[model samples]
Target: MRILILGTGGMANQHAKHFAAIEGVTLAGGVDVDPARVEAFNQTHGIERGFGSLDAALAWGEFDAIANVTPDSIHHPTTMAALNAGKHVFCEKPLATDYAKAMEMTETAERLGLINMVNLTYRNVAQLQKAREIVQSGQVGTVKHFEASYLQSWLVSKAWGDWRTESQWLWRLSKKHGSNGVLGDIGVHILDFAAYGAGSDFSKVFCRLETFSKAENNKIGEYDLDANDSFAMTAQLENGALGVIHATRWATGHFNELRLRIYGEKGSVEIQHRHDWSKLLTCLGDDIETGTWTEVAVDPVPTNYMRFVEAVRSGQNLEPSFRHATNIQKVLDLATVTDRDRSEHKV
Candidate 1:
């Protein structure tokens, strides 16, 4: 499988490294608006070709797939172009800025019979995978409730870097810069995490979003830091489970953490993914009598990157497909509406 990385940003570096390491995959090239950045990325990854724009790359038409590491807003257009060009796509999360665009991309990919998947990232978490397996296997019986939170202290700490001065971080905080804020940013991941772990899909959502002032007047140079910093949502699962899903960058003390607890009539599952490590704990059978939670040993799972390559080669679509991501985006789009009207929305 030959792949073209659609952006030269920070995430693109990871994509390049992983694809380069895949035995049967070729890096093909990278695309970026900045020629220098694309050139440097090509050199860093030992790639042979680089294109300054998607149009130029499509004209050249050497790669079989695209790893769309572009910004949130750029996903729909670039992905559509790739699919139209008969190239498979592995896109970053949220699929698109809104549900309409996401659904279009999903429909296009399916109609073309092309491989399409989103990098939900947390799907690689062994604990999350294990929790889903447990829930689906009836060990958890009928899920009744779940609570999921994705926490990050990037705004409160320099662990990732200074967001005040960095374009990468600042772009995420500005709506004009094609950012959907915290809810648009990591909200998709947590929503996917909770829903997938619980083995259910969101059927309804009531969301409240908050954009805290990070600067004087909340303006940083050409960027408007108006994107949401935090969000809390009450949601119902298709399986009749009630869940609280939330995410925030203002969560102090935690660098990056995604925690989920799923409760059912017969048993319960808990998953914690902090940084890159994950742990799973379960309460089942006799252990539930004493409120005892025992750690469950979980095996590793293939990452979205690996699965994308395999899907491309095998001509099979995988989970976290574009359609599934579109469903998640529907919930996210409804979230903004719920926040605006201060009311719940049926998904």
Candidate 2:
């Protein structure tokens, strides 16, 4: 399968690395707004068809699919164009900056009978797969409550760049480049993973967003800092389970910590991404309090590269597909409105 990748940013580079290692897949080349980066990326990867424009590449580049690794704001346009041009798309998360656009993109792909998958990377984690199995097997015994938090200290005021204009964080802080701030950036993963583990969609939500650090160019009071830096929300599942999801870039001393705990009548399970070993732990039965939580083995899940290639070859849809992602998007949309409207929002 021939594939063209959009964006030469970090995620694009990561996708390229995976594509290189997968058999039966060819990296057709990549496209980026920066011509130099595109040229350098092609040369570094030994690819021959890099282009600076998506339109130019879609017109002349012969490829079966596209890896939409661009920013959140561009996902809708890029995926729609690729699907319209008869190319399957593997897009980054929060499918689109807005839920309406996400619906349109997914509908278009469905109408075309094309495969559309979102890179909710946590789905491919071994621990999460086990968590899903545990929950579905009744091991958790009807989850009653759950809490998930994804924290990073990189966005703290003390860590801010010397100047906003020279700061690489400007785009994220500005609505012109991205949306939903931390909520869309890393919060979507938490929502997707929680839903994946619970095997149910969120039915209601109440959210609060915070922006502790303001962004500025070289001069103060030049640009408005509108994006959120932290968010906390309480959500209820269709199964009537209640949970809270909190995400922040201001957690000091935490580099990248994503922790989730699900409690049920029979037992409970915890998934920790920061821990190097014993990432999945569970305790159950009457002796739950006295008994120790045993480690669940981490059996690696299939890589997205493998899944995408096989799905393309077999003409089969893959899990974490756009349809599944739309459910998560509904949760996010509700959370946004709940924060804005300050009322219990139904999904």
Candidate 3:
């Protein structure tokens, strides 16, 4: 598969390396508005063409699929362009800034008979997949409670503002670009991860938000911003499961501490990401306090890109369609319905 990558962002670089390492993929050059980045990418990879625009690259490269790794704000337009050009797309998630654009992109893909893979990378983790099986197989009776969190320490600093003041085109800090901030940034993953663990369709969410700290979003810093610094939510799962998701950028000493736990009538499943592979601990309750959480050893799954290649090759759908990406964003949209002014202390 010849995979053309969009954007020259950090995530795009990571995608290039992962695809290049795979046996069947070719890292066909990259494109960005920055001429310096275009030349640098081509020079670094020993590739010939670095087009000035996405359209030019689409015209020049014979790409089977595109790795749409651009910022959330432009994910819709970029991925739509690729799909319109008759290429399958594997996009990184929060597929768009909001739900509507995401839906549009997904609709277009379906209309054109193109396979779309939203890169919810955690779904590709082997142990997490196995954990889902354990729950469904009646090793765990019926899921009852779920708790998940993704905590980061970057915002706990004295200079998180000073450090980021100049870095505002960042997709995370501006509400004008999308929904509430931290929720849009990390909480999207937190909630979706829980929904995925429950193996239940996301039903509804009621969110509570707090901004423990405030920062300007523009490099100009002229505008008072309304983005989330910390957020907590409780949601009802489609399968009669109860869930809570807590995510914040301001938690101290925790770079990215994520814990996903689901408790069921017969057992429980807990999975944590220790860098890459999900470390899974399962407890299948037997008698009174009989089951103990035991670490389950399992090799991690291969890259999500491989699944994209297989889908493109075999002419199959990557189930839990990319349209599901829009559904997740809708949850984010619903969470921010009360946060219109950003002056409110809580939503």
Candidate 4:
């Protein structure tokens, strides 16, 4: 499949490498507003063409699929344009900044009969998938509680008074941009894990959100401060299971640690991806009478982009349909809107 990537961001770089590694999928090329990024991407990946605008690339190098890697603000337009162009699409996670636009894209893809894949990359992680399998195999019995958290220190300590904190990267931290904050970013991951593993959707949410520090990005003249730096939520799932999902970027020592533990009547399983380590640990309950805690080896995960490629060509269902990701988005939405106090706004 010929693919065109549509952004100059870091995530755009990741998708570039991911697809370049695949054999059957052809990297048709890319388009980005930033000249340096566009040039660098084409050079690094040996892409055939690089356009300065989405329009030129969409017109010049007709693509079979598009990787929408731009910021949260443009997901809707970028995706809609590509779908209108009759191209399959792969958008970075959180789908859109919010559910409405995300759903629009989903429905547009569905109406146009296109294959749309969202990059909730963890769903493709072997350890996470292995944990899900362990739970579903009935070895875990009835799932009762779940603990999932994603942590990082990038935002808090990265020269706090920057445009990112100020309104410079305002679109990201803004509630309009689907609350592109940690909830939209990492919360989506755990929500996906919960729904995908337990086969349940979120019912209601109550949240405690805070922005600990905000230094003015003197140069950007934007209100640079904390916005949902920390989010804690208690949720009810469709299956009557209770869940807690916490996401924060203010942790002092941790850097990109994703930990998930699912408890059940018969057993429990864990997926721990901390730094360079990726592990899946299981503890069996009394049902077996001789159950014991054991660590299971998770298989290596293939890039879901490759699978989406196969699905487009063969008319097979993508391992994760957009519908699945939307369910995850509902949880994200719940966290953002549930405890809304009109006067209380973070950042």
Q: Give the number of the best model, judged by TM-score.
A: 1
- Expressed as tens digits, the lDDT of each residue in 193-288 for candidate 3 is 788777886666677787644543332354335567788777777888887888887778776667899998888999897453458898876531
Candidate 2 residue lDDT tens string, 1-347: 99998998867888998888898788998899998888888887778888888999898959999999888888999899899999999998889877789889989999999988888987777898898788889987989999999888765544545435543555666565576788888889988878788778888899998876453332234345677889999999999999999998888877677888888999999898853433999997765979679887877789877788778888998977998777777777787888888999888
Q: Deviation in angstroms for 62 in model 1? A: 1.1
Better of 3 and 4 by lDDT: 3
CA lDDT of each prediction against the hidden true structure: 0.94, 0.83, 0.76, 0.74
Ten contiguous residues minimizing lDDT sum, candidate 2? 215-224
lDDT of 4 by residue, 103-184 (tens): 8888988998999888888877788888878777888888888888888876655533443544435545555444557777
Residue 202 lDDT in candidate 4: 73
RMSD of each: 0.8, 2.4, 3.7, 4.0
Which prediction has the highest lDDT against the true structure? Answer: 1
Clashes of 2: 1
**Count of backbone clashes for each model?**
0, 1, 0, 7
Residue 326 in candidate 1 has what lDDT?
93
The superposed Cα distance between candidate 2 and the true structure at residue 223, in angstroms, equals 5.6
Q: Model 1 over residues 1-347: C-alpha lDDT tens digits?
A: 78999999999998988888989899999899999999999999999998999999999998899999999999999999999999999999879999889989999999999999999988989899988999999998999999999999999999999999999999999999999999989999999999999988989999999999899999999999999999999999999999899999999999999999999999999999998578899999998899999998987889899999999889999988999999998999999999999999999
Sorted by TM-score, highest first, which candidate order results? 1, 2, 3, 4
